[model samples]
Target: MTQIRSRPRSELFAAGVLVTATAILVAQFLTATPTAVVVGDESTRLGTVGWQFGLHDVVVIAVAACAVGASTTALLNGIGSSSATSADTTCSDTSTQESTDSTSSELLQARRQEWETVSERLASNEEQVYQAVLDADGVLPQSEIVNRTELSKATVSRTLDSLEAKNLVERKRRGMGNIVLLT
Candidate 1:
């Protein structure tokens, strides 16, 4: 599994610092004016500029500066949020994979248990079929066993093969059918 790291603190801090510096610079620029007119210089008093005065200009500059600051803050916050979301997504994927693996393991265990139960049932069925043949004087046709057990041909055939391999039954070919004898 892969580990996801959080957004770097330094990048967030730098963004904050940049926004703050921009606001400060905008404030300084808006308030800045030519030096005050000297009382002793008549020409300087007439020529020196004072703070610009206009309701519209002040409103426009203030609005523009605020918009810049707001947009910058929004951009930074968006980046941080996106990074956090990506990290969360990675964690979610890991959790999902773990759940899938656990489910698959559980399914495999269930299948193995089912196979064991089936094997036990098959062994029991084979024993019953063998006893039936012995009770019938050691000679029982495959059809009779199939009719008695109500099992499929393939299953009966496999069981008889297993019984023969165990030396519990002997097989003799007779025409198209096999005569099974309990040994």
Candidate 2:
């Protein structure tokens, strides 16, 4: 099956701005009040109505301004932060990442098989947390393990500590996050 990917945020934001502007213009055209009023005097052919600010107009203007500002900010950030890369650079990075991912998956599969061998002796929560880590390429962040297993952070941490004591997994500090690795 072919996957349908979404456009970048800046593109979506710009499109939104355009669509909103078009809708506002169409609505104004369809429901516009007259800009001129005829007086009962013959001195003037037509007296142009003075400018009047309505709450609706003010609201619309504010919304449009906000949309435009957001769209422009997104576009500018995308442009300024983008760095040029040659095809060779991109292909090299992609190939490296693919190899790393393949190795990780292989390790994870082996870890799963090992877990299956001793899963009968494991408690339900421990098994669940272990399986979650095994599914994560043998290395995952503790927070991600919690999210995947649908367990509370405290529960995941305690289970991980227990697993570490049994030599089934290893937890190490990685920056501000804890990285769990299958042993």
Candidate 3:
């Protein structure tokens, strides 16, 4: 495959500023007398006397400012570009997430329609909690079971314990919560 790259305006602008500053500093250093190279000295005034900022000092300060500006611009641009890169990754990931969500939703709906055909006899709360987990693609947090099934936390915990006894669900500790996985 033929690879192509695109450059952003901020990088190009920073590069231009860096190059210009470098060239000016180098040319001034090479062509000026040794006295002129001494920054902030009154010798640069040629005939003027006592405590004055000369042209050489001004040029050196301006060049330093440009170099500093270029580096800061590049650093800030890099930070902004990283966020843009993540946003691009999220846009790409959203499509795959939507497909997976839809497939899981369809499977859950079919299970809901056919739940009565199951061979095992489960309590109504157990069945509702199981359907909630199945709706979440068979992996869910225990706290979410309470929310999805509209049951109290105590009730959900008791139901989960009952389901565990029957080998219908398992709960694993995950940070501050338990992730319920269907067996």
Candidate 4:
């Protein structure tokens, strides 16, 4: 049996740097400060406000550059080491049809059968949770969602797992709790 592997730690680290850079950029934009320059005669002082790159801007730029560099490195490595495409047919067309066409509609219908199913199985709850996270526009704890939605920890965990399985959610380890994302 073959086992699939999760993403590499390097890629995850690159993604994390990217996220941090984005957040820093946002924070800089939100709280940018203008530098004041005094220009006048000796008797009087006039303060002229000028927009100069501050510490926040520098930090944002540095973080963004690191993110870009790491991402580029990861991409180059992935491309350079990729295996050649295989032409071998692993499954017959009949099996392919049975796997995709025959079950897709049923699964879709089942996903929409009820609210709980929609919340847990379908993308409805995932969408909601994702939107909520985006609306906050910052990293939020998983407990926030659990408390807000009145969902049990297990239910929230399962929903998160389902979301991750669907490539709609990602988790980042941050101290004790994982930071969630709607990828």
Candidate 5:
């Protein structure tokens, strides 16, 4: 005997609904006849061609409506079930979690404001140099900074010196060149 694997209830219900809808539509199609209506004066041989709906069309529309309703219900039910499960799983320590999330967001906002202030005080070249350091994993060799910023080594050195004076950057001697870091 072949063993059958059971699917999720929502999926199974959706599939069954879809199959039923398709079967009904197919049966309606098999029994349907092409229909048309003519309206106007027959004596003048002038008429307007118009379509006429039959029982088959009504059945098809009803099946399509049922299929749509079933799919929508399945989708909403799945979403609701998953959300409910997640809510139950994460219900513990809700207050602490909320506080921690808010605190982290606040810290992020403060850091963004601080950076904005510092950036406003920076010269164009200084900002470029700082960005280069930040892009280099928050610490970069002086040579790498020059390469990344595409600025002259002397300009990078001056910018670094200015940043260091402002306490926005730090430099450590690494071999013949210095490695720069954002403070």
Candidate 6:
């Protein structure tokens, strides 16, 4: 019998980044001083009352941003590299539907039926956008969805926004474009 391997359990890179960022943040806070440079007093001229960030401030901001981003990434896909392409990594073969070891085959069937039922109730534009992502196995680049639907980028974006608002789909930032995921 052929055995299927389950998803990988380690998000090494994201975890490392998170840990490093945490250390940096702690060190920064512990040593932090008044690093904000005030150009003028509170009652000074309108344009002269700006604050300039010193090196300490910039480092703190950068570390905080990195920590937030890494934590979000790890939390979302920490269980395994999400089956969704565009979250972190793409499937080795994007054209084929791979067996999901995380969920049983029967569960897959139920999920498919559930999606079909949901699709039936969506508006035309929403359905088109939703179908594009569904057809891509619950994840596709927003650009790809635009191509598949032959709809204007604006239309697809608007539809996606509506779908997201309904908690039917989610859009995640991926480089220049977003990746749409079925929720």
Best by lDDT: 6
| TM-score of each prediction | 0.33, 0.41, 0.37, 0.35, 0.38, 0.49
lDDT of 1 by residue, 1-183 (tens): 553334346556656756765676577567755555566645545455566535665665676677567657656564443342354456557777676657655754675555344345546768667656655645689888888778888888888887776656666676899888654
Q: Residue 73 lDDT in model 4?
A: 71
Name the 10 consecutive residues with the lowest summed lDDT in model 5. Answer: 79-88
Model 2 pairs in collision? none
lDDT, candidate 2, at 61: 62
- Which candidate has the highest TM-score of all? 6
lDDT by residue for model 6 (21-118), tens: 77777666665554343455674433433345568778786978778686767767654435433422444554433443333345656776788899
Better of 2 and 4 by TM-score: 2
Quantify all predictions' global Cα lDDT against the true fold.
Answer: 0.64, 0.70, 0.69, 0.61, 0.70, 0.72
| Candidate 5 to truth, TM | 0.38
Clash counts for the predictions, in order: 0, 0, 0, 0, 0, 0
lDDT score of residue 58 within candidate 1:
61
Give me the runs in candidate 4 sitting further than 4 Å from their true place: 1-5, 8-124
Models sorted by TM-score, best on top: 6, 2, 5, 3, 4, 1
Prediction RMSDs, each to the true structure: 28.6, 15.8, 17.4, 18.3, 20.5, 15.3
Poorest 10 consecutive residues by lDDT, candidate 3? 79-88
Error of 3 at 21 (Å): 69
